[model samples]
Target: MSVRKILVPLAGRAEDVEVLTTALSVSRAFEAQLVVLFTRPDPTEALPYLGDGVSGQVIEDLMQAAREGADQASGRVKSALTKIAGDAGVPLAEKGGEVKLPSVRFLDVTGRRDEVVAAHSRLSDLIVFGEGTTGVAGGTALEAAMMSAGRPVLIAPQKSWNPVGGSVCIGWDDSAEAAHAVTAAIPFLEEAKKVTILCVGGKELDPGPGSTLADYLELHGVVADVHLVDAAGRAAGEVLLEQAEAAKTDLLVMGGYSHSRLREFIIGGVTQHIRSHATIPVLMAH
Candidate 1:
């Protein structure tokens, strides 16, 4: 199960270059089409603040500035993505296959990030976005797409990254959401040479579930290792992260269990923690 199309939401911020690079790499590996989308605030929505008394000159000037800023950001994002694709030796269609780059397309959209990402996700096989700090709104687009588009999301950190290598660590909880996430992530796990089913808490809570998942993966020709962590004093998210780091896993696949409205995520402490501070990219489904 390889991805055939990927939607990457770019903010044109410097921090997003790594995400763009990661997306391109994945696109090349899977021979998928890459769609880079830049989102801008809708100007019409701001018109309510400009009263009828406002001078035409002022309005024109503001609009021009907005347009210029949007153009500049869009250009930067395009250039960065193009360069990454070129370095990877993937062919760019517009270049007539002379320049190696992925089949890339750029879309500049105005309005809300969530809406734009959700629309693209509906047309794509996967959504990729950058992960930021805890309080800050990092990976908001990815989260929104997951909830609204009913697709899987890949959240990459803001540093240099490599396509997932080695083993994939799966956080197993035996819930319906977890099952869905596992199924959605089968593409990645099948590609990975190794996989681990990690369970937190005691057998009294749930014991054999993780083993069953591991066995299922083994049947698919994926080498799987199952382990249980006590998660006593430490947070579940922290424990998971620590285990992943120790195992040197390249990717973490987990279910996103949420209790609150889609507007904001009200998730378990572990989920929130991993969403806020995981070093490696996370592939999540709800």
Candidate 2:
């Protein structure tokens, strides 16, 4: 399906601009609505961290501060969203509510950060995330979105990225997760200037897996070149990266999955390898 709405979880913290801008880039690629969900920390959680002598008034004060900070930070977020959406100096007041500017919308959601994102993402076509910019929710919200939202997520690297769809590479596998991922990534593949399906494993490329997917992409008017790569004892993730670099791919489409996903992240697996190593953006749908 076409990506019509993208969910970007925003914690009124640092790197908000970077994350929002990355969402904007993806939104522009598909002319999708950028649903910016601002997740503010619950002030009551601060009580434990407070000094022993602190009272309810201090709690109230912290709540007030959080509200004020959220307002100010959200304003800046809207301003930056408008600017990056293409029309700058549009006056912050005009940029407040929903405008025709960039299909940009905002919602102030309170609760656990990941829960909020996963809840709202049910209506979104895709979820976009920054590298590791975290707040009170910590950094695992992306994983929550992936596992709970039942949708695809585009994870942007730490550095700035633009024109994310051009020159794409797919890490092809026969897993259900891999299949779902490629389908979720169809919009990006359709928009890419060049599409390369990199088949990892020691097997030869055939009509069953990689070539079959290539054929399916062709049906959608996406011409892809399928290349089989022998891992040669190397990790599948490493093999995918080698091909990605060789092809100069800006984005890699792969399954956002792992058996015991957490264990895969720490021990050794394709997910872990790419999560730790890939230089380009990875669009994963689990």
Candidate 3:
């Protein structure tokens, strides 16, 4: 399905601006409305923790500081969205004979990050999150946004990415999440001239599931090739990367399989490996 509306969770960080730009590009290509959301922590939630030792004046000062921080973050997010929209030729207003360009709406939300994102997801066709700019925290935010939103999330790594083109790689395992990822990625797959479904496992494991997905794609008139890797000695992530490199793939579409509630911990084997080391951009769905 085509994405008609995209939600981008902005953190107002420099790195996140790049991710927002990429999201805008995708939105423009799809002729979609881009909703930029930023979350501000609620002030009332902080007052309960203030001890008796901290006077009323002190608490008020702290609250004011927090509000100021939120306002600053909101301004930065709005500025970035405006800049990107202009870059995409989305005009702010009409001139004498010129048509005004499409504009993005910046939403300043207050509450928990996950909760805010979840609410926005109900109204958006897709959600885009940036891989954390600061080590583990950033990665954790990206993962949480995807899980909480219950929608497709495109995670842009810290490394450089060219304009996404060429063959698309689908990391298949036949799970429900894999199915969702495949369905969510149809827009990209339709544009890709070539598509590859790669399953890294042995004969003892399931193979028919991926084949069925390939057949489904064939029904949709998409030309896809399926490959099964034995996973002889290398890790699954390593094998997947090797194959992607060999094929010169620019984007990877796969189910983000994980069981950890706190994604910052990196508890699961496959999830940990892919989050920390995947070389290509991953379109992940839980």
Give the best candidate by TM-score.
Answer: 1
**lDDT string, candidate 1, 1-286, tens digits:** 6678889888677877888887777777677878888998776677789999988898888888887888888888888877887777665565334433347877888888788888888878888878644443245676678877888888777566667644799988887767777887777787887788889774354668988898888787777888888888667778888988788888888877444444335445656677777788777788
lDDT of 2 at 37: 79
TM-score per model over all chains: 0.89, 0.84, 0.86
Cα misplacement distance, residue 240 of candidate 2 (Å) = 1.4
In lDDT terms, how accurate is model 3?
0.74
lDDT of 2 by residue, 152-202 (tens): 888776666787889999988877888888999888888899999888877
Of models 1 and 2, which has the larger lDDT? Answer: 1
The candidate 2 region of ten consecutive residues with least summed lDDT is 87-96
lDDT of 2 at 247: 85
Q: Measured by TM-score, how close is model 2 to the native structure?
A: 0.84
Rank the models by TM-score, top first: 1, 3, 2
lDDT of 1 at 30: 72
lDDT of 3 by residue, 72-98 (tens): 988999898788787777644323444
Residue 229 error, candidate 2, Å: 0.9
Best by lDDT: 1
Cα lDDT over the full model 2: 0.76
Off by over 4 Å in 3: 91-103, 133-145, 159-162, 203-207, 258-267
Residue 49 in candidate 1 has what lDDT?
A: 95
